[model samples]
Structures are given as C-alpha cells and as structure tokens.
Target: MNLRLSGRIRVSVFGVAILIAAACGGDRKTFAPPPEIFSEVDADAGTCADRCSLDGRSVIRCSGEIEPCPIELACGGGSCRQPCDAVATEGSTNGCEFYFQPPLLTTHNDWPYSCYATYLVNTSTVPVDVGIEFEGKALDLSKAIYRTLPGEAKLAPHVGAVMPGDGVILFVSDRESPIDNPRYVACPKGVVPAVLRDYYPDGTQLGSSFHLKTSAPVSAAAVYPFGGAASAIPSATLLLPVASWSKENILVNAWEAWRTYSPGVQIVASEDDTDVTIYPKADVHDGVGVVGTPAGVPATYRLQKGQFLQLVQPQELTGSAIISTKPTSTFAAHTCANVPANVSTCDILGAQIPAFERWGSEYVGVGYRPRTGDEHEPMPYRILAARDGTRLDYDPEVPRGAPLTLNAGEVAAFGAGVGEPFVVRSQDAEHPIYLAAYMTGSNGDYWGSGRSWQTKGDPEFVNVVPAEQYLTNASFYADPTYAETSLVIIRAKTDGEFKDVSLECLGGPVTAFRPIGTRGAYEYARVDLSVGSEPGVTSDGKTCYYGAHHLRSDGLFAATIWGWGRWTSYAYASGMSLRSLVSTPLLPK
Candidate 1:
C-alpha cells in the first residue's frame, strides 16, 4: 500500500564531491576506496544517471547528462520514469471512502436491528456527490442514540447528488418504529433517514461507526436485518473501502454455537490510536471484560475513532487472528447460526473481511441453489490456514471431510453438493487461504423425508472471494427480503473459452445465465436475481429488489449475493479485487 512516486532526482554537493574526489585515486590514503570503490563510483556516475530497467517497467534515459536518478528511476520532465506504471490497477469494491460497522444481528426477543447503507454509482456518466457521517463518542463513553417513536422525525445525513444508476438508501441504525422492523427491501423512493444521533444498536460502544464519503467511485452495501420482517434475520455485506482497510485480518466464522447463539468478530477503528490485537481461535465471552481473550491468548485493544470491538464466543471464531495498529474494519459474525446443528431455524451471519493482505491462493466453491422440491443439499465449506505447512489442492474432488494439510491456525470443513464445483488450491502464494461459504438449514433433512421447499432458508455465512480476487466490474445489491434471490457467477477463461459476461438489472440485460460449474478453471454461473413473483419490485420509484446491480466482465469475475427467506438466509461477495496478496505484515506473534 505504498507506491506513490512522482518526482525525485538530485545529485549535487558539487557532484558528490567530484565522485568522492575521483575515488581517491590521487591519495587521502584511498579515502575509503573499499565499498567496491563506491561501486565504481556508482558505475561511472551511473552513465549520467537516470536508470531503472531491471524489469521495474522500463526507463533509462540520459543523453545530455544530468546525473542523479536511479533509486529505481523517477527523473522528472527530461525523461527517466517508471516511478509508477506497471499497469494493472485493480483494487475494488469500488470506493471513495467507506467505513461501516454493524454486526450483532439475528434477534427475536431482544429485537432492535435495522441498519442500511446501499449506494451504487460506479459511474455511467458523472453524477456523484454522496456523504454521511455518524461516528462520535466512545473511548468507553458510548454513544449512538436515535429512538424515535412519538410522531417520529429524525432523517438528516444524505448529503446530495447521486444519479448515475441511482440507488442511495442510508438509514444507519434503528430502534423506533412500532418496534422497529425494516430489514431488507423497501426504502427506495428517496430514502435517507439517519439522524437520531446517528443510530446504532446491538452495542459495543464508541459511536458505533459509519462514514461513507463519495464524489465519484461508489459501490457500498451493508443492510442488516433491514426491512420486511418475518422475524427478520437478514444480512448483507459487500462494503470495503477506507482504501480497503487492512492491518491484518482473518476470522472465517460460522458454526460454533446454535442454541444460545455465538460466533462473532467485529472490530472497527478507522484511525486514532487504534491498536487492536486478539488471537482467540475460539473460547471468547465478550460480555466485555476486555475481550476476555482466551483460547490461546493474545488480547490487545485501544481503539478511538468510532471505536468498536465485540468478540462473542460459543467457540468457532474460525482460526481467529486480527492484528492492527490502524487500518481496521473487520467483521465475520453469526449471532444465530444453525446450519446442521440439528437445524430448526437460525440465521444471521455476516462478512466484511479481507486484509491478511487479502488472503487467497485460489478458491471457487458454488453451492446454494436447490429449493423447489429441495434435495440437492451440501454447501458448507471452510479452509483457513495462513502459513505453517499449508498444502491443500482439490478440484473436481476433495470435499468429503476435506483437509489436505493445513496448520497456522488451521481449519478445514467440507461439503459441496448442488452441481458441485470445488477448486481449492494453496501451496503457491506461500500458502494463503481463508474461504468460508455455508448455508444449509431451512428444514434440513438433506434427503430423508422433509423439506419439499416449505420455508426455505436458514443458516448463512459467506466470504469466498478468491480466484485472486477476481473482478472486472461489479456494483452489487440484491436483497428484496429474499424469498430467494440468486447469482453465483465465477467466470475466468478468455483464452480457453467463456468470456462475454453481463448481468445488469432494472434497466435490462440479465438473460438468465445458467451454466453452473465447468469443474476447474472457473465457469460457474446460476443467475436468477429473484424468484417468487418472477422478479418483482416496482411501484413508481422505478424498479428495485434492493436495486442497483451491474456485473460486467471481459475476463476475471467472481460473485455471490444469495438471499433466502422464511427461516432466513443471506450471503455476500459480489464485489472483490482488493489485491495485495501478502508479502509481509500479517502480524502473527
């Protein structure tokens, strides 16, 4: 995260004292003529300086002689560049500033959820300007008020503009509304709401975080138990800007608690002291007590700018490990979870993670599809491991009890079903991992005699974006309360076949896709962005089902965005490419 270079080339002190007095050839007792004689006086004054051509992308100019350029080139107007230009610029989940913080979902008797933040304007021709603040108290002072209910009236941080492919939504935080209930879709016609002291419930203190500037790049998403409740159990992630925050992260999360509900990991700091640490691969309590950081011990914590730190337990913090010293914003939750723990309703699972230098050696799972007459089943996945040993391979096989070797904070898990798909990989990028994909419950019998599609949706968890963080274009969001919403995609081919990808929405395209797994080098598919009522969402304010989608592709791709219902479900991904595949700075010890 440090490339910036635009100018620098200086070399005078009378030309380095005449090249160190001509390398002392005339005496001063060979004045240090040993460092290879200053590398032969910098290779004869670097042939008039201005070099840089060992593949750092060309640049070696020097004709009239000016001297001083070549600490990897950058010589200003007279030529000698390569200071920055390798052409590959990719780091997305589009951006212009963002920093959400909303986990702790899934609730029924403790109610109080609703949070929002949908915006999408990855440009179609100008129209930008967005904004929203909220973040002001908590060094332990706690804040975030907004209770409204007596003739209600709060709304006030929507900023302005926002047109190209319009879709704004900001309602960050809730609690007042005949018992608050708005968890997925229905806030489209000019919705803004965000002012009861900038809402935020499900607590952990410090002004509950929320920022999101914008004047140009956009693509955010963070609905949380937001609207259309059947006892709301929603989820939706895809938010990752703050220039892709990262000081270190890893916590795949899901399955660790079912009855009293557990599995959590939230940390949001955005800067101001911010020191955070925390190892715990499991065994946490979070009734505060400063993380009670147990399982293997590590604990640290300091927070300040919109502070946050909530670490529930019930076991399963999947290979936990989050380091930080500024640049934080991680989330991997599950306050309900119940995929196979004897099924029977349970939901809420969050995502937002990416930073252990953007983990990924390769991946591509693909399950979740079956529902009409049910039966295909399987799903579940895990992976983890960010170092030590780490072998793994897998392709058209390897799901039955997975584990081809892992170590540093291990984790494996399996299952795949529903046209299968798989793909795994590791042993390369110095062994990177961290997959995660679960979603099963919903009357699970897998095949026995239950579930013919009655109330289909339950467990949830999603974090699979790897294939080297593929993304040619994406602008995701599809939640409309979820009676079922699809989109799995995958792509990647180009020279060996498959390419033309599209998707679009409300304004057209979206020709049903369909394919579903080609086995290895990627090619999945499975579209259908909405099912019941054939793709509903329309009523004056244009069209929507949690509107705003795009998805292009000329090559690299990757997506997810599921969404179930009844018992409830939700997934994430539809946006990635935050590059940086580790080279140091994982902060383990």
Candidate 2:
C-alpha cells in the first residue's frame, strides 16, 4: 500500500471569521517559526534522518525536516495549513504519525479560537490531545477518534502506519478578545464513559457521555436548532399547558374502575337526575366505548359523581396525563372556557387549547383516542389560550422567528428540523418557560454505535452534540398566532425514534403547564428570550458530550425526551465539540 495517498480535502468554515483582511489565497508576511522551536531536517542525503522511519531502503516521511521545502510554516497562528510535497515514500513506524507545519499550539500568542481536522499521519502519532478550560476553571484533556470524514478525508487504517483518519476539532480560549475568542472548549479527560463533556467556571460540566473517535463530517442536509442569530423574544401569552398525571394514579383509577364495573358503569350526579349511558370496559375487538350526552343536556357537561366514561388508553397508562389542551368557545367563539376540573385560571380565553390533531386541515379535540369507539366525545377540557388571531408556520429551511409548532419528536425538535408552533392569542406578554425532549435510543446509551440498529440507521440520531442537547433553564415566546402554524415534520426510518419533545416553565410568576404523552412534533428546537424573566438564560447553558442520532429507515425504534426546569445559570458549559454529531444546513451556500 502506498501509504502516501494523493487527494485534496475540503475544509469547512463554520461561520467564524479568522483574519477579516484576506480571503483564501492573498497573503503578506513571510511566516517565521516561534522562538525556541526548530524544524528537524533530514541530515543524510537520500537517507532516513532525525526520527524518520523507513520501509526497506525507502525513507517513509509523513512529517519531518526538509531544507529545500518551499512554503513558509507559521505555528500557533491558527492559520490555514500550507501543504508541502513528499520527496520520498516516508512511512512512520510510530503508532499514528503526526506533524504540524511549524507552530504547535502554545500559551503565548495563539489565536483564542481555531478549528483543525486531525488526520492519521499529519499531527499526532498517538490519539489527539484535546483540552478545554475556562479562564478560572480547571483544564480537561482527552484522546479523540474520528467517526465521519468531511470533504475527501479517508478512514484511518486499523493497523497501519499511515491511516487517513481525520475529523474537525474546535479550540476556544477563555480570553476576552472580541474577534478571536472561541466560545467553547473540550477537554481530553473522559468522564461518564462514552459521553463528551464540556466544562466551564472551574467545576461546571455540560452534556451526556460520548464514545471515542466517532466524530464525522456533518452533511449539508443536517439541521441545527440553534441556527438563528441571538435575538430577544418579547413577551407572549400561553397557548396551552402540557400536564402529567401519575402513571399509577391514572392506571390505578382506570383499572380499579374497569374491575369494579367489568362490563358497564353507572352515571349519577349530585345535580343531574338523568342517567347518562356508560360503557363498562374496553372491547377486545373494537376498543373502549364512550357514552354520549342525552338530549337537552348542557354543552358543558361536568364529570358526575362516580359516573366515569370509559376511555381506551396506552397500555403503559399507569395513569393518564394531559399532553396538551386548547381553549374552547360556546357559540360565537367569545365564550372562552378554562380547563375542566383543573382550575379556573387565566383572565381571558381566546383559544388556549389548540386543535390537537392537524390531519391536513381536519381537526379534533386535544384528547381524542384514535382507535376507540368513544373517539367522538368532545374533549373533557379546553385550553384557555388568547385569540390574537396570530399564527406562525414552521419550515425546515426557514430561519427562526418563523412560525412553528412544538409537536415533533425529541430528535427533530431538539436536533435539526423546525417544529409546530405554540400560538399565542395575546399580542405580546411574558410567558417564561423551559422545554426538554427525552428519548430512548436503541442503545440505552446515546453514543454507542455498535449497540443496535437504531443507532446506525438514522443520520438524525447523532451521539455527540454541541452543548444544549438537554435544554433546561431557558426562556421563550410563542410565535405569532395570526399566521398559519407551519409544521415541518421530519420522520426518520431509524429504530428507537423520537415522538414528542416537550417544554415547561420551571421558574417565573405564572403557572406552568406540563406535557403528558406524545402528541406533537417539532421539526427543529427553538428558544425565546423576550417571554421569560431571565432574558439572559438560553440554550447556551449546558453542553452534551454524545453525538445526536443518525436518521435511518428500517425498524421499530424510537427515542423520546422529557424536559422541565428553571435556573438563572446551569452547572454545564457551552462551546464544546459537535464532531460526533450530525448536521443539516438551512441554506446551500
């Protein structure tokens, strides 16, 4: 094998500007090596010299000294790599041969931020020494391996001297330079095995665990949720509350009731004398049956004493939780009503409960059971949302602030795709909140690729993510409710997929709503600054160590995440590495 492979690899400029003055080719100064650093040259003419290895009589040189080499090398400058030619078949016997041009990173004058992709033979003989540290925080270091290749980089050979293993690593300095500061830094030390961890403020750690060497080239199609410019999300109103009931309570109540009335249950009320028909249990063949309100009954039918209607639910329904609820109207859409039995909160109810199902214009109550006979019963409660008549839509390619829904699975909402919107009827009002998505991947662990089909099949299931994978303690605003809420659905064919990614307000003056079950989908995750009290609190709070799941299409697996919380600051740090995660660009250029 001619270890010296010939090829050109394209480098990615992740929206960061290094030198403001020069484009790609223009240059000025003759680069000089830093003081005390000397280039080791090949002393023996037509022979191996100074740490150079040899295969037979051929001197294998991935990186060594060459007096006649042309280009000037500048170390510690964070500048683009200037290529040099290989005069001989220089093969390195070292574990994984590596050599930087001239300036290796040092503390003195290095740029605060620099991005470099490590290849098997260019800069490291052993695993790369990746480190992350804040000005006052402790320094962390670790060994890294590559997962995917960007541009034209090849895979590293399992047992060879010149493997093509390469992937990008971003370095950031805690220095307060307006131009050169890299926002995030990763350490070499591996903790929580398999997950990538970013640290800040001395002891703060961000994100879950990431496996070693799984970082790869992100495709142009990968979508990132934090794609918008940092902006303020003015105050907004609440659309609906996602509430959860104890699984045991819901199932216990349902099961107990089912056992008591084996086939039929009686309906009696302290106020109403007329008996409402009830279905005792769920049918093995057609599911559960719901009783209808007899003639002359008021539209708002309260649950009678010991008169419960049969509802077919999830097998895991240890109890039932209200995933979401929208506002309801009496006749002319003005008689707004609050949630049934929950509480009589909120001042004005425009349209709190949104149409739960968006079946291509066909709508239904918030809690309509899909495969049951009682599916026709009007939903028990309605969400008390404002009717600013403001609606927004979601588009995978559109920028944030564009209307969207909070109805996607954990991966789509929290990862790349934009999602359904949470509409606000009121023009502008503060609605402090936190959103989170929880999912179970094929591997109980998010970074393990060899574990199951779910991990290998989908591009969306990225293991190593930049910080903020688990969004907590953040503020947000509802996209306008007047426009049509654009819902961009990103369904993956991979196993261990995600269904609903929910958000809850843990801090703030107003009461918060909790999510019960999976009901909506988000194409991409979003945060708002104007609606919450801690305008400064954002997704930058924590960093996750694992890669996001990849997208796939051949099995029965789904991952869903549950989120909730509120804190001025988090224990995690930001600006870690996304080398292990996947990417989807909103624009082509």
RMSD, every candidate, angstroms: 26.9, 30.6
**Candidate 2 regions with alpha-carbon error over 4 angstroms:** 1-131, 134-147, 151-427, 437-589
Against the true structure, candidate 1 has what lDDT? 0.59
Per-residue alpha-carbon lDDT of candidate 1 for residues 283-381, written as tens digits (9 for 90 to 100): 555453353544555666677776666666566666666777777877787776767667666667777777778787777777656765433566677
Could you say which candidate leads in TM-score? 1
**Model 2 lDDT per residue over 1-589, tens place:** 0011112223221111111111122111221111111112324457543332111112224355322322322111112122111211121111111111101111122212222122112222123333222222333323223322221112221221212222232222212222423322222222111122221111001111111121111111101001001110001111111110010010111111111111111111211121222111122112223222221121122332212222222121111111101211010011111112122210111111111120011011121111112222221211111111212121222222222221111001221111222211111121111121111121222222233322211111111111112111111111111111111112211123333332222132111212211332212322222222123223334311111112111211112211111100100011011111112111122
TM-score of 2: 0.17
Worst 10 residues of 1 by lDDT: 12-21
TM-score of each: 0.28, 0.17
